[model samples]
Target chain A: MQKRYCAIWFRYLLTDWLAIRKPELKDVPFVLAASEKNRIIIKAANQLAEKQGIIPGSTAADAKAVIPDLKVFDFIPGKAEKLLAAIGEWCIRYTPLIAVDAPDGLLLDISGCTHLWGGEKGYLQEILKRLKGKGYYVRGAIADTIGAAWAIARFGKEKAIIEPGGQTEALLKLPPAALRLDTAAVDRLHKLGFYTVQQFIGIKRSALRRRFGEQLLLRIDEALGTAAEHLQWIHPLHPYQERLPCLEPIQTATGIEIAIRNLLETLCNRLKSEGKGLRVAILRCYRVDGKLVGADIATGRPSCSVDHLFKLFALKIASIEPALGIELFTLEAPKVEDLMIDQEILWTPEGCGLESPQLAELLDKLANKIGAKNIQRYLPVESYWPERAYKPSLSLSETTTGKWRAGRPRPSLLLKKPERIEVTSLLPDNPPMLFIYKGEKHIIRKAEDAERIEPEWWLTQSPHRDYYLVEDEQGRRYWVFRSGHYDDADSQWYIHGFFA
Target chain B: MQASKASIIQQLQQKILSWQGFASPAAAETKRMGLGPLEDAFPNGVFPTGAIHEMLCPTREQGAATAGLLSGIVTALMKNGGVCLWISADRRLYPPALLSFNILPEQVIFIDVAREKDVLWAMEEALKCEGLAAVVAEVREVSFAQSRRLQLAVEDSKVTGFLLRTDLKKLTTTTCVARWQITHLPGALPDGLPGVGFPRWQVELLRVRNGNPGSWIFEWNNKGFVPVEEPLAETEQHLTRQVG
Candidate 1:
């Protein structure tokens, strides 16, 4: 099989995207500018701006003087690459192997895929027509090699498609810049009066490597099919996926449910047989209008239960909108894990602790309803500070490495942040006599001695806290602390928690 | 004639209790649940395990007090190395504090959801899991229908449920087996010591199905609940005066 590659280039990638978003800028001359070395330089310009002698790389001020009504917008960095990648993903409908050519293009390995659209000419036409319909000005070319396809897409003048074995002939007339050479190499070639690639096509490899560097020779060999070009091909889809093509588009929630149930039954059955379970599952619905809507569900632990997984998807089915009906449904489990077989409980009346199937299923339902992050299990950390005493565990089966600190009367309800309270103590070091919190006065009848605790030296630099357990007349206990030493003039008292 | 009439009334009461799904337990099977005389208030003189118990905590202080009392009960329920679920919109029950009531913090799972509806739903789902020893939910409000739903879930699974009602704006009737109110009581050290004493709360049974309602003072001594027989001199006088 002859490996044919296609490259599609966006002439004004950034400006075209901007015009599409704000259609009012369709006819206006505009340039996207960015501050380079503290000077605003145009990064991309529309065709109208280019026709009016305002080009990219010129200062914004200079471009403005040339056309006073020119619209200058801030150029967002990395916007072009993001647009190209998204376009490449959309192109997956045509071919499976797509690589993002950063800055302005995409490369598709359409080796065996072109026959699906009849032939190479039809494939190239279909892509260009669809992309142009989406408000993008695109030019595409097909060739035997990626290098040739890329060069012809951007710089070829005579023809867009190079014949299968005529890459050398195609490269004979194009400029040296068409070979994707750096500016210095191209400038050297132009200084030597070698205006076209045909002038240097017969040069010896060793001589070209010494003068123009290895990149020039390598590009030539890659273009003429003497060297293999490896591309970072994007993985098309997850390995564990099932697709359902609907005879009639699904318009109701019940129809969607049936589709999901059918998909899960197949997927879960395969997973169970493989002794594996899914941790995350996504259901993507392709509508008749070429738009896609998706719903995703995640479990706390690996799950292969069809009923349990269906219940999770059922919660999110209401959020999916099947406008004009869904033509296809695809279920993919991107994350999976080895599942332990069910442990039969023969005699033990009390079930397993956290690893029990029932507990995990219950948590999965809760997590799917709320979110997985909201469901938490905490383990004790060895710390004196109440706020730094515990951390969330990773999973249900995790155990604490350290013992929980006891012998200290910790508050049951600790406030998220300490609240300031107005206090009056009889002496500099004695506990407060009374405190007013939230505009309400409470007389302190009993107070405990202050327990001074210093902040962790490595974590923070702050004042030590002198905590006092004080009881009000109504028998309510509050955990209050003074910010600094009692003698410090700026010391403040804050109520930290409520003790039962 | 009086003896015969009293016996007839006792037999009729037993029949009514049986109708409401409260069967009298065998004498040997009724083990003391460490709640002391508080357990006697129940119909069969046993702390109901397979029922929903609703506790009202109107203020933060009361909420903390209820947390203490609930942890104490949970410790007894989870003595056989079972896990418990704690679901709330925003939980403030410090994990370390559970240590004081003889519970390993790791044995309890906390689910902090944003909406009360999710909290109730999670609570009901957790209650349906027989593997969990108990399920505690801190919800702002639960209607009669919602509470009844939770009660029905526990009826089949036989899992204990504790509904901590933080907001009492609409305290409608529900199918919960009991309603409780726990408030902080002043800590007292023996011989007038200077430090804070063990936790003490005035546990009150505001409502109970086919059971007597009463208030008692109990203290947690790091082992189990110890009912404080006598109140302090001043507060006792104050309480008597208010009652009179």
Candidate 2:
């Protein structure tokens, strides 16, 4: 029940990494070195290089002098840190609570996870076996405290899982460097003839603080579990998501639907109690073969009604392929909004169909079956240009404050972009007599007055447009615009839209 | 009880055809949506509400005319202030133009789905909702089975559905109240005025269940459609084929 931690010390991490890349180099004496102002310093050494008295942080020249045949490698920046973090992520299989100790080590909180793998012995064995099998030289130790585990892993003679309340005894034989003190303090301790932790274990706290500063006492107290130091474990992220792990993998549509309904019930209940509603819900099904298929739906208004949400999701339920079988399903409401309840009306306000909640749900279902962008309602804006005259509104209840653009006839459908048309006008300024669009010639049977729409000079340098409603021989009406003044050489004609 | 089994089936089918939608009417009488002389074209002198109608157009020009005609119809259906849902693979109906047809830009909801399957599915969903006045769908193809499904959905909720068939004319077997082909027609000049005429549509009734098929000229003046007297150049019995 006590908190337990595991420390994985990656000795000779850089050389081990190079050896993993090149198996032939493992038996050779090699050192990873960094260049500083034309001086090469050893950062890490392989086991063979370490035997020749080559010390890391020492000059590469001294390492080569100790062993002339020592292989040298450029120290890659952040490579060791990245490798340690990757190994820590892999350790999620062992314990979800794990953190990168940076550079060359990982710390794992194996308190509750150890029993899942049949106790600490089996858990430690599995971790060591897998990491070592990956071509890395690793030393691992477990203790009640992270500091104690870290010290025992890097400095202890035996790689043992120290029982709870045994951290002090376990750290006694280790060197003072195991306290993770600064180099200056370690040398000062050595000058004081306190090489082993056993020599400082019985020292007075105030006296130790006076001689070696408070850091030493803090380190010793942390290892002994008298002063707690929190390990920055990998914090797991759980959004407004509900996960359902099935007892047996479900392959049938009915089974999947049932699972989805169950998950939705719990999720919707949570949102409702929180006075919030989901604008979008994504249902992800994890297949037995490690594949994922999902279906998502969006609501115009925030909604928590189970039946309505179910119907919206039901529209696309057929699209989700169950595949071989689905083992887990996660329903997540990634976009949510506050559900502010509207004041109940004593009398129905004309029942314009927009105010009814049922209508909102119906529109949601329709949008899902089609798409969100496809369902649009517009409101008048205070602009003269056709594109700026109105704006697409998400909610039908949005009131229009601007005056509706005059009673002039606008095309039933507006083209996404105006298309160029070849035209011949009666005069230089008159409406076109004949026009060519899409290779089809349209003879204008009738023409209306040109409504001059001036461009916003502040917006662009384009000229004003003279828009005319013309009826072709086919009886189809079109809105055409001529850009720029008649005197301008670059004046162009375009068919903007159709009149229904 | 007095009718024979086969006769009963025939009568029941006739009743179903009279109803035209997915479900029977909540009210006893079938809704008559006919304006002017067009009422004579439908069964019981009424434009069938809560039913599915086909508006077929062969060309892109005619398709726009058909959209105009349907917008008028939808606006009429929602005169009591309701929403109209329009679903299409590529939506060409400009929201601003619906304003000229007396339908507010906000009253009409447009859904542009890239897939025909989703368009039909959305139509069915809209047709099942009791709040909507009508649903208009522009699609490339609608198999008899798909139309039947749409018909069934509209039947129960009594929501009207306008199947605006554009680009193709492949209506063989479908259970719609009426099949129509609308063409762009020259609007009549009011008292010989030199200006654009009111929006006119030459509507050809290809087939009508429990009613006689006929062709007529109509002019929409925003308020509603008014039957305009044609030149009377064609014979009454002569069947007119729909032009692309």
Candidate 3:
């Protein structure tokens, strides 16, 4: 079958929206104006204002003269594009592919989709009637090419639907301006007495290029179906999405679970065959009450196992509320990675370390139950600060070249931050003889020599810390640090960590 | 005739222990964790793998001591290149300190869950994984039922589990193979030195199923656990109380 395109034009896109919002603005002769170059120029004129010779692009002062009762409203930037995008999304129900034509039109690829609405004529009528009922004036035209459909939608006076393979004849009667050219090019064509496309349809290729430049020839070829035109859809097609449209609304958890199982089975089959695994998956339920509820699950590693993926999603099944029953269920894997075929070994050998598939699956379950950030793996780094000595590894397979510093006696449990302690020392720089922590006094029986650790100069200018391993009389060991030099009068003491 | 009768009685006792889930040393991986005489307090004269051991830590100091001691044992279990999972709520176990115990810090995965309930959940899940060497979880409390569930998971996977119970207020009986409490002891330097010596702890086996309960002083040097004789002359007699 031949490819066909349909273009829908909204003549008064913004004004129609304003009239629908404020019904009083329906019959008023209004024009939307915007300030440009210190002058308020009219950007769009309603039908009533248009009939009164208040054309757009004229100064607001001149438009006021044409109609003394004319109401001028500010032209909001990007309002037309927003309106077109909303309408295009709604048009997805008609055709799966819809692209915004910008300013005032939409292009839909209606090749295989027209048969769903009985034909191109019925399809065009259904869209135009629905949009018109929403208080907007819309015209739609269908042809073999996007350029031809676009031109006919905005300029064709007699027909709205051009027959298939008739774009050439349909484009012949339209004026040169309908080819969507720059204003300068249109003016040049008008000045050359080429009022309609038929006037230059038989021109020599080299002569046309030299006369009107390359754009005119390109536009003509696109209009006549000799060249292909590509369009960017509003919603990019999801390649890993599976949809289940239920004949009856699903109200029970069992039904929803069945839907999810079916979707995952199909999705996992595809992933396994393609040697790819899903890293993130989302399940969206479209309820009958016009509300969408979604649940998403992510994996620590790329996985395609049906049972494992199902378990992760099962933990999140309670969060999805199927209020009034769900009519549609869509499962989409938005992020995926290539899965090595050899990683699918069913029986993992003993002591596989981090490379074990069972370990990754266990972590994925825990992450989904709580969160991903709560689970972490650390690798040693060459730093003196206790906190900076290790960095969290992003993946299980990540390795580090730096070895952990084992020369010094680091505490088994390091506090998140050091706690202030009241101390009484015999001398200024000597270790505290007795310390009061949390209202309990501990007399120090033995104290190690102070190991002064200087702050990394490049990172911060904090004072050096003199750390001492002090064991209380009760045999509880604590790591305490004295800030700054003893001469700094403001030097304080704090308990930093615990030793086993 | 008397020797034959004694051998039959010993064989019957071994069968009864095996029926109670205490496998013979040859039947399971009999890798010594270098705990010296401490292993004698467990059934069959071996440290129980595929079983849960609960450690009571009433204070932060005890928690640190427990972590240090567990890391020493974990190093032996991970000799086959297996990884270990350390699940806790608000974990403060510094990874760099594990290096002193001869443990590759990267080989131990740390999970910091905000909820105490999830810590147990993660531990049970980690215990079920056969590839892991062991799972060490720190929770404020664990109900007997929760500990039983974790014990069941480890039994099938043959993975060791250590439960560091920080809050012993609700301490109750559980299905753990043994319960331990390790408290910090004042380090003793050689020849009256003026610095902190190697990590020394008074390891007490508070409860052990089907075995004797005892306490001893153990010190972690550069290599492994070494049983230390208490320096007090009067308590030196109790140092030999552990049965082999």
Report the C-alpha lDDT of model 3 over A117-181, residue by residue, as the tens digit: 99888899999999999999899999899999999999998898888888888888999989989
Q: Runs in model 1 with CA error above 4 Å?
A: A1-238, B1-11, B25-31, B231-244
Tens digit of per-residue lDDT, candidate 1, span A50-100: 999888899999998989999999999999987887788889999989998
TM-score of chain A of each: 0.57, 0.55, 0.59
The residue pairs found clashing in candidate 1 are none
Error of 3 at A203 (Å): 8.9
The order of the candidates by DockQ, greatest first, is 3, 1, 2
Model 3 chain A weakest lDDT span, ten residues long? A340-349
- DockQ scores for all the models shown? 0.52, 0.36, 0.60
Residues B119-186 of candidate 1: C-alpha lDDT, one tens digit per residue: 88888888888868889999888899999999899988888899999889999999898999998777
Candidate closest to the true structure, highest DockQ: 3
Interface RMSD (Å), every candidate: 1.3, 2.2, 1.4
Fnat for each predicted structure, in order: 0.76, 0.62, 0.84
The digit string of per-residue lDDT tens for model 2 on B1-244 reads 6569879876786688767633333465554444567767775456788789988876767777888888777777887788888888877667777777778778777787878788887888778887578888887778889989998898678788988876465657688889988877755576757668788887888888777788888888877888887765532322343322
